[model samples]
Target: MGGGWIFAVIVVGLIVAALWAFTKGTPTGRQAGSGSGSSDEVAQLRKNLRVKALGNDALVNRLVQAERNRMPGASEAACYKAAIESWERDNR
Candidate 1:
């Protein structure tokens, strides 16, 4: 029963990755100017990832520590991505 969240997160991650890959090269998908718009999107993505891990305290802790040990900024995304990858690996 507890493993259900892992499966859900994996599915969600895959779907998101597919959508990103599909749109990455499109004209509309390519945003310019290095604006805060992309930063907002990244922040939201990290929030959603963290929320998905909420049901598992251990996972959340690992992500938090991972971020702390990493650089002060641009680390949450890496940490969350690592957690998702580890879930995919350990469960298989």
Candidate 2:
């Protein structure tokens, strides 16, 4: 009788774990209705864009400096993005 109870508990535990895994495998996971994505989405997008922009030219310090000078009120990130956009335009 004790062995039967133990077997039942193990089965229940396995079922719970399987359910948890299935839920996690979903596209949105636990945040189905949430408008915002995972916290890293913005950071990942920035990194990916930066990589694409710099694919042809690794040395863009001068361009970034020029962009910063053009937009004195802009933040460093804004200046960098502008420089990348300029680079993409000129290269193409």
TM-score of each: 0.34, 0.39
Model 1 C-alpha lDDT versus the unseen true structure: 0.55
Candidate 1, 1-92: lDDT as tens digits: 87999999999999999887754433223234533335564554455445556666676677656655664564444555455445445555
Candidate 2 stretches with Cα past 4 Å from truth are: 1-58
Give candidate 2's error at residue 42 in angstroms.
12
Candidate 1 Cα errors over 4 Å, as ranges: 1-54, 67-74
For candidate 1, give the lDDT of residue 86: 51
Q: Highest lDDT among the candidates is held by which one? A: 2
TM-score of 2: 0.39
The residue pairs in collision within model 1 are: none
